[model samples]
Each structure stands twice: as C-alpha cells, then as structure tokens.
Target: MTVWQDDVARDLVRNVGDRLALLTRGEGSHVWDGDDKRHLDFLAGIAVNSLGHAHPVFVEAIAKQAATLAHVSNYFATPPQLALAARLKRLAGAGIDGRVYFSNSGAEANEAAFKLARLHGIGRNGVAARPRILALENGFHGRTIGSLALTAKKAMREPFEPMPAGVEHIPATIEALEAAIDDRVAAIVVEPIQGEAGVVELPEGYLAAARSLTLKHGALLIVDEIQTGAGRTGAWFGFNHEGITPDAITLAKGIGGGFPIGALVTFGVASSLFTPGSHGSTFGGNPLGTAVANAVLAEIEDAGLVENAARRGAQLREVIERIESPLITGVRGRGLLIGIVLSSPIANAVVAAAQERGLIVNAANPETIRIAPALTIGDAEIAEFETLFTAALADVQASLAASETEKATAP
Candidate 1:
C-alpha cells in the first residue's frame, strides 16, 4: 500500500529542497510515481527524453548495444560511434566538412566547445595573449567549470568563483554583441533559444548578427543547441532555422533520448584545431551512447515527431492563449519548448496545482512555467494540457484572493 517516501536521506547535494515525487516508471508521455498515480509529463526530463520514457525503440537499441559492446576507450573506434558522428555532421549541414567530439552531458559538450574555441583562437590569429569568451546574459551552457564560466547566471556562477577565466557575459542584444566581439575574442556562444531564462526566444536575426560579427572579427561562433537541438525547435538544429552557420555547435539533452551523451560539432578550420593530444573523453563516443542516439534520431525522423512538435506546439500555444485568463500573460518559444508567462509570481503555486490535477509541469522561474513534453505528443494530449494549465492558473489565483481576504479580515 505504501512506497518509499524518499526522505532526502541520501545526503546528496542540497540545491533544491526535498523530493517532489519518486517516479517508478514511464511509458509514452505518462509516468507513474511511487504511489502509482499516473501523470501526464510535459517537462520530459528537462527536455532530455525526446522519445518519451522507456520508449521501446530506445530501450531495444540500448539493450542490443549493451549485449554487443557498451563501451570502448577513446583509443578505439566502433561502428555506432562513427555512424552516429557522421549522421550528426550531415544533420549539421554539408557546407563545412565537420568532425564530432562526444561527451557525457551538455555541460561537457560546452566544455569541449570552449576548449576548441580557445584552440581556434590560438590557431587562427596567433597574436592574442588569451582569447576572451563571450556569452549572452541569462543564457545557460552547462554547470562544469569551463562551461559554468560561460553561463550568465550570477547566482549559479558566484558560488564557485574564479571560473575558468577569460569569460564574460553580455546582454542578448545586437548592440552588446557588436561591442563585445573583436579579433582578440576566441568565441561567442549563444543558445539560439534561451532555455533556462524561462524559455525566452531570441530575437529574429540575432543569430545572423552573431555569425556576421564573429566572422568579421575572425572569432569562432559557437551555438549551444543543447536544449533546442534534436527536433525540439521544429528543425534538426535550431540554427538551421536561421539559415546561417556557426563555426561550432554544442549538442546534448535530447540527442540521446534519455541516455547521457553530448557532442561538439565543428566545421572549417575549427574542426581540425584539436590535434591528437589536445582533447579526449574516456566514456565519450562509446558504443552504447551512440547506438541509442542513432535510434532516437531514427524514431524522430520516421515518426515525423519534428513536424508533430511544430504542429502540436502551435496548438498548445493557441489553446492556452485562447483561454484569455487574466493570470496568463503570454506564451513564448518554438515547437514543443514553451513558456507560459504568468502575470504574478505564482508559477510555483501553479506547478503544485497542476501536479495535483495529474499533469506535471515546471515553474521555470518566478513568473514562468515551461512545457516541453515529448515531440511525439499528439493533439489530444495538448488539449488535455490546455485544460489542466488553465485550471491550475485559476486555482492558484483563487487561493491568492482567499489569502488576501483573510489578511484583510485579520488586520
């Protein structure tokens, strides 16, 4: 009758408070918690589960690869690793002959990209003492030391000071971008869509401007597509939508479909910058991770999930926007990545209410709730979310009204 309460007993890193739910298993777009309660998952493992949980294809791919070969050191090569790398490069486009470097997470991907940028700076100009790195303010790359240095969040960065050096943050504006980029700069990194900044969509032509500025300054432009990559943005790559190519691109999150994998894809001279001894990942580009990535990408392609995400995402936004609730201000993002801007800072309250109603969502910020479910989610599921989200907002607002009334009466 009872399952483990998961009392935060492990003495794990205490960033957030106690656990919300101990999820037992997941299938399709739904998950069952320890209590056996089913909930529609819209967060999708923070955009990691591209194909939903325990997807049969992904599961089989992992199992088969595990039987054949799960891992091999960077000293060796496997068919899956080579194939997946080639596939990713093709998806990256054919304009540049690119090479792929794999890692275990988005942070690692960004870290590799960072190293490549530094090497690129050294290789290209050969005059600067040290190349400075630039990233958009509020744009999240990852949490590792090198990647963290590039991230723009002060609170996340301040706890661990003196990050990797030569890194600077700038506002996501053309003017700031124009001012910051120069020959001495190694790279300029930007998330085509700011995921952690409440799924904030970047302004149109921003990427184009970044590419232009970086090119003019002879700096490498690195687009961190960790969140927006793998069909999440209704394209193979978010940068693809803009029609401009960056010198380098970082990927992870959805690429492995719940499996831990990351990659740095670089084109042109940047691709050849990393010589034999420059960089390496022991567990990176292993057989198992690449196998799953190929399978996940296959499913995304065969099932038309990318187009589905675009379709359902539009409907999801439209249905919620049509609610015209006073609590909701607007919806922003592309494809399945969505952010509902709340009029008040009641996003956490809204998340709780939605969870109680059998729909799982995330209060991405004080006033924003993010919806990033599986790309395979259909219209029916989208309709359900609309109903649940509207009700959750209503409930939170009504509770706020009641609390204010009680306060007034007490005074």
Candidate 2:
C-alpha cells in the first residue's frame, strides 16, 4: 500500500472499503492521480459533479460567497438561501404553496422527509392515524438511521435491526404498489430510477399508477431524486417525465454540483406538514453552499447542459450499442446516468480494467457497470470514452477466454 492507503488503514473506519486511487486534482471531465496519470472521470463523483471538476463558475461562486457572508445559522436566512429555495421550488414545479427545507446531504434531506411522514401520520386527536411507510424492495435512499429504515436492502438493514418501525418494502411494479398501498400508509417513497440498483428504471406507468394510488389513499408520494435530479436524467428532475407532481421530493447530489447540500422540496399541503421545531440544520442553507449551487445551476441553465445531457446521452447509448462485445447485453437508464448490463458477473474486473486503461467507471452490481459522466461532456469526451471502454471490455473478454481455454485443455 502507498502512504495514503497506509494512513487510511491505520486511522480510518473500516466500514468503507479500500481506496481505488489517490486522485489529487481534477479539471473538466478528467482527474489526475497521485502518480500524475490522467483518467477520464465518467462517474463524476457518483453524479455529484454536475458542472465538472474545478469549474470556473463553481470556484468563483465559492470565493465570492466566502468573502461576503458564509454562515449566519438558520435563525436568520441569507439572500442566497432564499433565492435557492425559490429556484428549487420553481424548477421542481412545486407551485405557489411549495416550501423547501435545506440540509447538508441527501440522507439528512430524507431524514427530514421521514419526519414529514411522521407529521402526516398524526390525526386530529394527535394519534398516529397513518403508521405505515412503503419503499421499493431494492431502492436506496441513504445510509442514515432514518433514511436507512426506508431503504429495503436486507443486508444493509439486518445488522441495524430494531430499525425505526412501520417501514415496509414492496416490489417496483404498479401491481405491487396497488396491492401494498392503503389509507394507513402515511407515505410511499420511491426513486424515479433506482441508481444504486443498476440504474433500473421503474416499469411503465409505475409513477403514474403510484400517484393515483397515493392520491386515492391520501398518502404522500415522495420521490427520491438524489441521483436523478439536477438534469442528470435528461429532466430537471426525474419525475418531470411522468408529468405528475409528487407531494414531496428529496434533492441533493448534482443539485450542489459537487458541494455538500441537500433539500426536501414539498408541494401544496405537504409543505405545511413540518411545523416549527420539527426539523432544522445548522449549516444547511449557509450562504457559501447556496451561492455555489446557485452559480452551478445558473451555468447549467445558460449553457444548455440539460438539453446537452439528453442529446449526448442518446449518442452515448448508440455508440455503446455499436460496440461488438459478447459480454455486453444492453444498456439501461436515462440521460447521463447509464448502466452497461453484462452477460456475466465480471463487473469488478471490467472496472479495474477500465481504471488500468485510464478511464473511470464503477460496477453498480456484479453484472452492471454504471456510467455517469459530467453533464458538461461533449463529443470529445464521448469519443475518448468509447475507445477506452471498448479496450476495457476487450481486456476482460480476453481474460475470460484464456481462463476457459486453460480449463478445456487441462486433464
């Protein structure tokens, strides 16, 4: 191990796995490791770096905001804070009655949403009238205790047993939703695309059916847009494709464009669910983060990155489909958030091989290689990716072929 790895092993917590590479600096769609080797960053910090690394707008905003006013706490809101809330409300189509709650990360945003669900559960007599909360079976919200309770991965939740009660998981299907939802459910949280679950899109009409069911049962329809928000999925928010407004939506990741910020945006009556003292964050809407995010979002709007994401995403899919690789089955996801489905469980090898070839991509699962590049990428980035990714696939295919040959000739 290198010095960084040695330090990490000696001092850091073991929950996180070993480090991949010691990335030192980044600019645009590329980053350099400790060895000064350049690698194309296709993951984009797991869809956080919307504007890419070391963007002038991001840096200028941060410097300007820090020189002016950084933090004044939640007691007194800053202009940037108010402006961002309004911007998010407008972009999310939350309407006139919409409200925004700021937090430092997506997990906190979802945690506040969890509290919102609990608030909605209270009856006229102040009893828990609606106690149930539903989430998709393989959905990932966050790692916080409150958010973790809503996540349905058994391996993740089993160790933290005796989790906050009243949370249930259902299949990601309209029929499953119809069977599971009822008046007793306070809310049903879902991702427009299960980013962590191999960029899986919900079945056709799933969101529309969910909207109808939740509306019929008087349950809040909460959309988790952490990974799919901020133009990552071709839309401003993933729910826009369905044209159905959610009761509330959690925002983070690309919203801050690599900065740490999260928000729970509520529409109509859901805005009033969180009363005073219900939820709060100290550095949630500080001027520094808000100003940077505002600048990042403004750049996205002015530069037409949203439209670019749509066009480039289609071009990328076409390019990947054209590559003749026996290991590749198909591609999934919308816009820049793509998943290359493999015929075998060789995702780890493929990722490693891509890294060796100076391209960065990750395995969403054993057979799914996720690719979420910066929204600013164009034809040049795409061309480079095609070459590197094709080479990576070839490397893995050759290794597999050699292994098969060795076994066939043995004995």
Candidate 3:
C-alpha cells in the first residue's frame, strides 16, 4: 500500500511537491512529523508563525471570534476589521489619513497595491499610456498574474505569459533604477530585504536612493514587506529601518500569526485611489482573521517580541560567524531573517543532513540556507541549534572531502 506521502506526491499539484510533508505539527521552535519524530524548526512556517504554533493568545482569540462571528461580507464594517486597520496605520506612521484593504494572502495584497498604483496614475494619463511598474531583479512579489508579472525569475514565469501588462524589471541598484524610471512609470516595487532570494539585504542608502529616483520621476515607491513585515525584521516594517515612507506598503505572513490574511496600506495621496466599490474581499477582513491578528499584535507588543528578535538575531549571527567553516562564505540578514551563503552549491545537501539531525531548515537558493526562526524562540533553542548546525557542517565537510578524493581517483 502506498503511504500518505506517496499518495501526496502522486495526487497533489507538483508545485512545492514534497516540501509540504516535511513538518506536521509545531510548538514554539519545535515540530513533530507523522513518524512521531521531533525536529527543531528554524523555518517557522517560512516566518509566518511569529508567536509560534498553538499560542494561547491566538487560539483564544480565534475561538472567541469564531463563536461571535467568523466572517461577514464587505457590505458592512466590523469592529475587529476596523481595529486592525487602525493599528497597522499607526505602525506605518501613515498618520490618521491612511486607508486599508484586506486580502486573503500576500499575492492578493500586492495585487491590490498594483491596482491602487495604476489608478493613481490614471488621472494624469487618461488611461491611454498607462504607467509601467518597475520591479527589482531577483525580487519576488507574488505568484498571481499581476504580481507574478513583477517577479524576476524566468523559470517561474515563462509558462504564464500575457500577464497583466505594464510591468518591467530592472537591476537592484540606484544606477539601474535611475536609468529605468521615466515619466510613464507608475511605481517601483522592491523588497526591503529580498527574503526568498537568499535573504539579501539592501546596500546602505539603496532605499533612500530608490526613493529619490522615484520622487524625481514622479513614480510611486512600493515597498513589498510581505516577507519582512510584522516585526520579522526587528521593526514594525523593514523599510522603517531606512526611515523612508513608501507610497504603498504590502504586508502578510505573521501578521495574522499563521492565519491567512494580507493588507494593502496606502498613505496620503495614494489613499484615495480606491473609492467605494473599486475593490473588496468577501473574507479578507473577516472577524476571524482580524480578531486573531489583533491578538497577535497585542501579544507581540506585550512580550516585547520586536526587541527580543533584534537581540537574539544578533546573537545568532555572532554564533554562526563563530562556526568559521571554510565552506561558509558569509552570513547575511537582520533580525531573525538570516541567510548563510556557502562557497559551493551544497546547500541542499546541508538541508538534508540537518533534517537527519532532527532540525528543520531551508535552502533559499542553491548556495544559501535561509533561517527565519520564531520570534518567541529562546536561548536554549538557539544554543542547541548552533551545536547541531556546526555538527551538520562537519558532516558536509567530510562528505565533500570524500567526493573530491573519489573524483581524483576516478577511472
């Protein structure tokens, strides 16, 4: 008889095929599989469970809201929905004039933000020559048609052509940006830290430079904080580190503390782009998602998770540097979003070996291991992870040495 994993492989969609069966359940920084085996989770549901799994606050809020009201149509306003929008606006420093739109996922958030940008430019051009969206190379926004058009990976996008038009890709540099922006461009979309592209951090002044270029050309600046927002980068939002406010910000992952939710936040002039009936979601700002999100935000503040993330993230980086392995090229990231770049493309092997040692990790790319652990993780978990991680690297070293010797003695 075929096992559940085999059935999954055969029946489920091939996209992210085997990755879904890796970890079954989670609590704090640990997860257990269907085989009753435990693994220390450094992935944290791809940085979604900031409060960790099965947190009491989240559970209670969801349970209470489920009892009260699970979902309501967009025709009416709900308290939880209004409360979350208010809190996010304050965090964005968008003043009292900001507006919010809810969506079911990150891609939807980017989709809405794109619509807002296009609408903002419509008044100037009369819809004849629409403003083009300029995005960063090696940057990932989302997989939806419109947002996918903004994504730079050719392999992920070639099959889906004729995507919503007016999206352009340029290099991730000030010079590249300065050359790309023109009067017809609507917005420039970027990730504060390119999380999926190996947690690549922006160069100092890169954001400010982009802001300047966009402002000079009258192009809107869109910061896609979907992966790095909600205190994941040790701040309310990743762009806050640069102290630059973007025209629009997209957020998801960890905002709902694992619940499916996304938000499009617009400030000042951009706020009025979406009038009544322009866009809406049936379950986007439901009581269930918003109630839990409100609780998650309150819990983060009460526990000082943002500060803890900064301190622990720095400590974890220092420990990783102490590994001093020749194969390790460098460690790059801020807060808990870390990426350890290797000199060779042995990152997949490292992930397998780490899994064998009862640890869960991810290879963001062929040569980089991304680590975005839970914000609630403590010293003990990190200490154990460092020890196991060093041992895993040693295993990699031994295997590589044997492979080299075999190559030298090849017949």
Candidate 4:
C-alpha cells in the first residue's frame, strides 16, 4: 500500500518550515484546500498569477503552447522568445535601445545583472579593482549566491556566508546615497519598492539621486522589479511611476503569468554588455514559457488590465481606509501591491485569522500584511475580501483582548 503523495511531500521536502494550506484548486481570486475548504486568494501565488486562477484564456494559451512546442535548448531560437523580447523592449520605453537575457527565476535575473556589472568594469579598466556593488538595507533580491549577497536581510544571508563579496548596503536616505556612492563603485542595485520589507516605498528623490549619482561616478544602476512588474503596480513598471530608468532592470513573478520565467533587461550602453560566453540558461525562454508570457502581455494590453489594476487598486485601498479598522494603522502600496500596517506586532496571527475566515493574505513582516491579488480580480471579488478581512481583523483583536483579560486575572 502506498502513502498519499501529499503526506510523502511533507515528510521528504526541505522547505522554510511554514506551510499554511495545501491548495488543490484555484479560480479567479479564490483557491481550495485539500479538505475542499475555499479561500479568497489575495496572495496570488506570491504575485505570479497575473490573470487569476484558471482563466480560460491563460489555460488555453499554455495548453496550445505545450501541444505545439514545450521547450528547446537555449542554442536555438523560438518565435515566442523573439516576440516576447520585442514586446518587453517596447514596453520598457523610449530611450532604451535595450536587449534581454531570459532566465527561470528572479534570482537568476539578478545574477545576470550582477555579472553584467563586473564585465562592465573589466571592459572599462582591464583587470580592474572597481569591485563594489551597493544594495539597500531592507531590500530582498533572491536566495542564490550572488543575489543573496545583494539582499540586505542579514539573517537570510548569515548561514550562507562568506557569500559572493564586494556587496554593501546603503540606508534608504538621500544623504546616505550622497555619501556612500563614489567612483569606486561598479554598480548600485535597488528595488523601486522594497517588497520583502513590508512593501516599503523608496522615499521621494532617492531613485532620482541614485540615477544622477551613478551617472556621475560611471556606476551602473540596476533595478529589481521582480515583485512589482508586469502590471502588478498598475503601470507597466514601477520605475515608470517613479520616472527613473536604470541601466538594467530584473524581472520575474508576473512576467510569465503563472509560469516560471525571469529576465534582465538592459538599456543603452548596458544593452550589449553581455556578449558571447558571458551568460546562458538552459530552461530560460523555452518555447512554452515565452509563449505563455506573450499571451499574458497581450491579455494585459488588449483587455486594459493595467488600467484595471490602477482602478481596482484605488478602489481596494479606498474601501480599506474607509473601514478604519482599529487594528489597522495605515495602508500603503501602488497598484495592487498593498501592505496593511497593524497597530501591533500581530501580523502572523492576523494571517492565520484571515485564512480561517476564508481569505488568503500574508505577513510581509511582524506588523505588516501583504496583499497581491490577481490583476484580473473584479468588484465582486473585492467586496468579498472586504467582508472576510473585516471579520478576521475583528476576530484577532477580540482574541487579543480576551488573552489580556485572562492574564490580568491570573494568580
């Protein structure tokens, strides 16, 4: 007799040790557990499901591509790869006569950008010592060696050190930028909004300062848009909202809709930096993935999903603010990448409560709840979220109050 596969997976796999639910089905902004309980899916597979769960168009696109041509080696070119590259270039905007290096995850995208900065240094001053890369204090890149080095969360990185060196952190301040960035730097990488740091927005003038200072010191500016790209932030890219284009931008998460794909898009002088022998990825831009990505892009444009993201995001935020839940102190995000700040350090408890109430949400930090729903979610779904979320908050707060009373009366 064979044990169930789900039980085997739990015992065998090495993971981060936090498993919320075993989701078996998804449609629109909702998912179901193995027990057949339903959940409103605000997490959206950590911002990967662009069109929501099991959209007919997205399903057909994947199925058609898989039937036709699923994958091929990187040495060959596919029509979807070529077309997706062109689409990304055009959407990246006017000044960048750019090129793309596709990969399988956000970390790989940053790895490509990391190497680009080093190769750039070698090209500039043969066997050079300009070996510095600067990232932000709370920024989250990825789990790979190179990207982990760039990520600022020390606890995630301490076990892996001595990591790929020559990387440093800059405080999120204009003064820190003014002081730390100098000629010795090779490249400076940042997230336009630090997603892992509770969806924290970069203070005003910080990105513009990075752009200007990198220009002054001949350092490359690399932007990580992994969690914020592909209409997740309402605009085509977060940098577009901030009005600063970096030398290169890293992408993933929403680019392939629900599939796994990542890309490093470089602009102007940085476009041709990665020549032959500089980089490669076997599963990158495979036929099926790129075809799905192309379909996602078309759906975003043709259906005005980007505009929908803007409008719905505005509506969600407005309603949440108006609720004025005592537990909630403030709400912040652009487009659909929202973070709800709690009045206390109870985000993890809130996550559990929210799930119990049939809503899916996440704790970006101890005091912040993250919401990255599908771009295709409509008014009906948003209303459901508002109702469920309010119940969850009230439940948690009441539990906390009861706990305090019990403690007060305890001998």
Candidate 5:
C-alpha cells in the first residue's frame, strides 16, 4: 500500500511544504474542501471571484462562448472582444476616443501597458530617450520580467535581477514621487490601494499631486488597478474615487469574474502610444474570456454591486472595530479590501485558527491579516465571519498568554 504522498504526481515537484496540496472544490462567499467541509472565504480567490463561485450568469456566458467561439488570432477580431473593450472604456470613462489591448492576466496587462509607455516615451516621429518607470516601495505590479522590474518587493525582484533597466522605485508619496521623476522617466505606475502591502491606501492628495507632477514632467501616470478595479474598491476603477484620469490603466482580477483576462486602457494622447504592430497577445482578446468579462461588467452594473461594496465594506469595518481586541491594533482598507493589523506577528497563527474554524483569510504580512470578501456577500455572511474572526483572535491571545505564563513559571 502507498500513502498519498507516495503518489507519482506529488513526486514530480520537489517537496516545498505540505501546504500547497490543500485542495478546494467549490466556493461562494465561501468554499468547501475536497472533504466537503464549508469555509467562509474572505480572500475571494485573492479578489478574483468578484461574483463568487458558480455564478450562473458567468457560467452561461463562458459556456456559450466556449461552444460558439473560444479563441482567435490577433489577425481577426471577435464581437465579444470588441464589446468588452467598449464597455471597459465606458466604465473607466475613457470615452469612445480610447483604445484597449487585452491580455491573460494583470501582469500581462501591465507588461503591455509598460511597453506602450516606452513607445510613447520614444515619441512618434523621432528617436527618444529611453524611458524610466517610477514605482513605489512595497508596490506590486506583477510577476513578468517587465512588470517585476516595476515591482518594488525585494523578495520577488532579487531572484530576477537585471530586469528591464530604467525602472525606479520611490516611497509612496507625492513629494517623494515628485523627487524621483527625472526627465528620462516615461511613466509613474501606482496602485490606489497597495493590496499586497497590507492594504495601504495612498496619502490624501497623492493622486492629484501625481497628476500635476507627471504633467509638469511630461510623463504618463499609469494606475495599476489590478486589485482595485471592476467594483472591487466600490468604484469602477480606484482612480475614479480620486477624480484623476491616468494616461493608461491596467486591469484584471475581477474583470473576468474568475475567467483569465486582463486589459490595458488608454485615453487621448496615451491612446496613440502603441501602433498596430507594437504590441499583441495571442490569447488576450479570446472570445471566451472577453465574453465572460462583458457579462461580469453587465452584472455589476445591473445588480449595483459597486454600491453594495461601499455599504458592506463600512459595515464590515464597523463590526471588526467593535471587537476591540487588544490583539487587534487597527483595521485598514477601503471597500471590500480590508486589513486587520495585529499587535504581534502572529497573523499566520490567526489565519490557521480561522481556517480550522471554517473561515478562509490571508495574511498580507507578518502582522496584517487581509480580507477581500466578495462584493456580493450578504449582511449575514459578514456577521458570521466577524464572530468567527473575533473568536479566532481570542484563541491567538490565549495561546500567547499560555506561552508567556509558561516562561514566567519556568524562571
């Protein structure tokens, strides 16, 4: 007899940890493991399942598209692709004057946008100076080489050094960003709320200041809305709340309602940045992906999910704040994207406790437990998680107290 670990499939990859094998079958605002145990999902597939699991509308759209037409090369255009592009422009308020390039993920979207920035930096008529991109510390763009170069996380960068040069990092601030912009810089890439960095919101006036500075420096402002777009942040795009129009915006995550799709949106001068042959993705505008994205956008509008996110986010924050656990230092994040800061670095412990109690959450950092629940989660679901989460924090506190008591009694 052979154990599960003895299987050839598990042997293919070097054993990193016993963690990755955890399998989940179905999820809603929650999910069930292969064991059929239910768990409240606060991560929302890291903010991908905007409509949650098994949404009938998305399923229907994907099924219909896959059956009729799933893919096509760049040489041909499909109706779903055209429709999604138009809808995204309307949602981003890019107007009919804008253009879009589709891709398969946020990183790919950013990669396409980055290349467009470089092209724009070089100018249309003459050879221009190589353009540099100014990204912020703790900012996350994507995993691709170019996007990774714009990303500021050292752990993700050190492994892939000598990344496309000309990318720079500055503190997430208007003044610091202003200081970083040189004549050779082409664009400043920013996330309205830094999701992976513990849901850090940009300082007030930061976007406005960036717009002014970029205008002064003749650079484009590229807002990476990968985690905050498509009603995730209670707005179509995070920049909408800031009242600033960026030169280019990259979007993914919930845009496809769990389908793999990403897009680069541009307006005015930025629209002309890329020529026909400058950039392309084979699977970028596939019928299946775009059709699902189109349905996702329509569902969001018809159901007013963005407004729901705003109202429910406040309610969730209030409920968590009422917990008032000494273990909980504070709660930060906007809309459905939330972060609970703990007094210690035992966030992973809290996450484990929550998971054991049928709740799924993520640790954004050692001390910050992040929750990005589905935008459509009901009031009852939020309350249930609040109770489970508060209790989990108590468990962490009790464990800490017991450990401290053991230390004191030992001496």
Candidate 6:
C-alpha cells in the first residue's frame, strides 16, 4: 500500500474499505491521480458532478458566495436559498403551492420524506391512521436509520434489525404495487431507475400505475430522484417522463453538481404535511452550496446539457452495441445513467480493467457496469469513452478466455 492507503487504513473507518486511487486534481471530464496519470471520469462522482470537475461556473459561484455570505443558519433564509427553492419548485412542476425542504445529502432528503409520510399518517384525532409504508424490493434509499428502513436490501438491513417498523418491500411491478397498496399505506417511495440495483428500470407504466393506486388509496407517492435527477436521465427529473406529478420527490446527487446538497420537494397539498418544526438542517440551504448549485443548474440550462445528455446517451448506446465483445450482453438505463450488462459475473474485473486503461466506471452489481458521466459531455468525451471502454472490455474478455484455456488444459 502507498502512504495514503496506509494512513487511511490506520485512521479511517472500515465501512468504506480502501481507496482505489489517490486522485489529486481534476478538470472537465478528466482527473489525475497521485502518479500524475490522467483518467477519463465516466462515473462523474456517482452522478454528482453534473457540470464536470473544476467547472468554471461551479468554482466562480463558490468563490463569489463565500466572499459574500456563506451561512446564516435556517433561522433566516438567504437569497440563494429562496431562489433555489423557487427554481426547484418550478423545475419539479410543483407550481406555486409546492414547498422545498433542504438537506445536506440524499439520505437526509429521504429522512425528511420519511417524516412527511409519518405526518401524513396522522388522523384527525392525531393517531397513526395510516401506518404502512411501501418500497420496492432491491431498492436502495440511503444508509441513515430513517432512510435505511425504506431500503429493501436484506443484506443491508439485516444487521440493523429492529429498524423503524411499518416499511414493506414489494416487487417492482405494477401488480405487486396494486396488491400491496391500501388505504393504510401512508406512502409508497420509488425510484424512476434503480441506480444502485444495476441501473435497473421499472416495469412499463409502473409509475403511472403507482400514481393511480396511491391516489385511489389516498397514499402519497414519493419519487426518489437522487441518481436520476438534474438532467442525468434526459429529464429535469425522472418522474417528468411519465407526466404524472408525484406527491413529493427526494433529490440530491447531480442537483448540486458535486457539492453536497439535498432537498425534499412537495407538490400541492403534500407541501403542507411538514409543520414548521417537523424537519430542518443547519447547512442545508446555506448560501455557499445553494449558490454553487444555482450556478451549476444555470449553466446546464444555458449550455443545453440536458439535450446533450439525451443525444450523447443514444450515441453511447449505439457505440456499446457496436462493440463485438462476447462478454457484453446488452446495455440498459436512460440518458447518461447507463448500465452495461455482462454475460457473466465479471463486472468488477471489467471495472478494474477500465481503471488500468485510464477510464473510471462502476460495478453496480456483479453483472452490471454502471456509467453515469457528466451531462456536459459531448462528442469528444464520448469518443474517448468508446475507445477506452472497448479496450477494457477486450482486456476482460481476453482474461476470461485465458482462464478457461488454463482450466481446460489442466483437465
């Protein structure tokens, strides 16, 4: 291990494991490690870097905001904070009646949503009239206690048994939703695309069906847009594609463009669920983060990165399909959030190989390589990605063939 790895091993928590590379700096769609070797960052900090690394707008906004006003707590809101809330409301189609609650991360945003569900569960007599909450099987919310309760991964939740009660994990199908949802359900939280579950897409008409069911049962339909928001999925928010407005939506990741910020945006009557003291964060809507986020979002709007994500995503899918690697089965996902499905459980091997070839990607699962590049990427970045990813696939394919040959010879 290197000096940095040694220090991390000795000092840091074990939950995250060891660091992969000691990245020192980044600019645009590329980053350089400690060895000064450059890498094309296709993962974009797990879809957080919407404007890419060291973007001038991001930097300038941070500098300007810091120089002016950074934090004044939630007691008094700043211009950036109010402006961002209005911007988010408009973008989410929440209209004039919408409300925005800021948080520092996706987990916190979902935590607020959890509270919203609880608030909505209360009856006229202040009793828990609606006690059940539904989430899809294999869905990932966040690691926080409140958010973790809603996440359905058994392995992740088993250790933390005795979780906040009343959450049920149903299949990601319309039938399953129809079967599970009832008047007793306070809310049903869903993701447009299950980014952590191998960039999996929901069944056709799932959201629409969910909307109808939740509306019929008087349960809130909350959409988790952490990974799919901020133009990552060729839309301002993933739910926009369905044209059905959710009761509430949890957002983070790309919204802040690499900065740490999260928000729970509510539509119509759902906005009034959270009473004043129900939820808040100290640094959530601070001027620094919101200003930077505003600038990042403005840049995305002005530069037409949303359209670019759509066009480039299609081009990327075409490029991946054209590659004649036997290991590649197919590609899935929407816009820049793509999953390259492999025929075998060698996604990690492919990721390591890609790293060796100076490309950054992620293994969302054993058989799925997730790619979430910057929305700002254009023809040049896509071309470079095609070259690097193709080489990486070839390397993994060759390794697999060699392993098979060795086993055959030994037999």
Ten-residue segment with the worst summed lDDT in candidate 6? 273-282
After superposition, the stretches of candidate 4 with alpha carbons farther than 4 Å from their true spots are 1-10, 94-96, 123-125
| TM-scores for every candidate against the unseen true structure | 0.96, 0.99, 0.96, 0.96, 0.95, 0.99
Model 5 lDDT tens row, 30-77:
678756788888888899989988888888998898899988898998
Clashes of each: 0, 0, 0, 0, 0, 0
Put down candidate 4 lDDT per residue, 136-223, tens digits, no spaces.
9999999999999999999999998999878889898989988998888889889888889998999887888889999999999898
Residue 181, candidate 2: alpha-carbon lDDT: 87
Q: Which stretches of candidate 2 lie over 4 Å from their true place?
A: none
Give lDDT per model, in order: 0.88, 0.94, 0.87, 0.89, 0.87, 0.93
Report the number of the highest-lDDT candidate.
2
Error of 5 at 327 (Å): 1.1
Candidate order by lDDT, decreasing, is 2, 6, 4, 1, 3, 5
Off by over 4 Å in 6: none
lDDT of 3 by residue, 1-411 (tens): 338777777788977736534456777788898777988889888989989888889889988999999988888889999999999999889887788888989999999988877886685547735468888889998998889988998988999987877888888887888888888888888999998899998788888988887788877888998989889889989998988988889988989889999999998778888888888888899889998988998899889999888989999999999896888989999999999999999999899889888888899999999999889988898998998898898899999999999999999
Regions more than 4 Å wrong, model 1: 1-7, 94-96, 123-130
**Model 3 off-target regions past 4 Å?**
20-22, 128-130
TM-score of 3: 0.96
TM-score for predicted model 1 compared with the true structure: 0.96
Give the alpha carbon lDDT tens digit for every residue of 187-287 in model 6: 99999999999999998889999999999999999999999999998988889888899999999999899899999999999999888787778888898
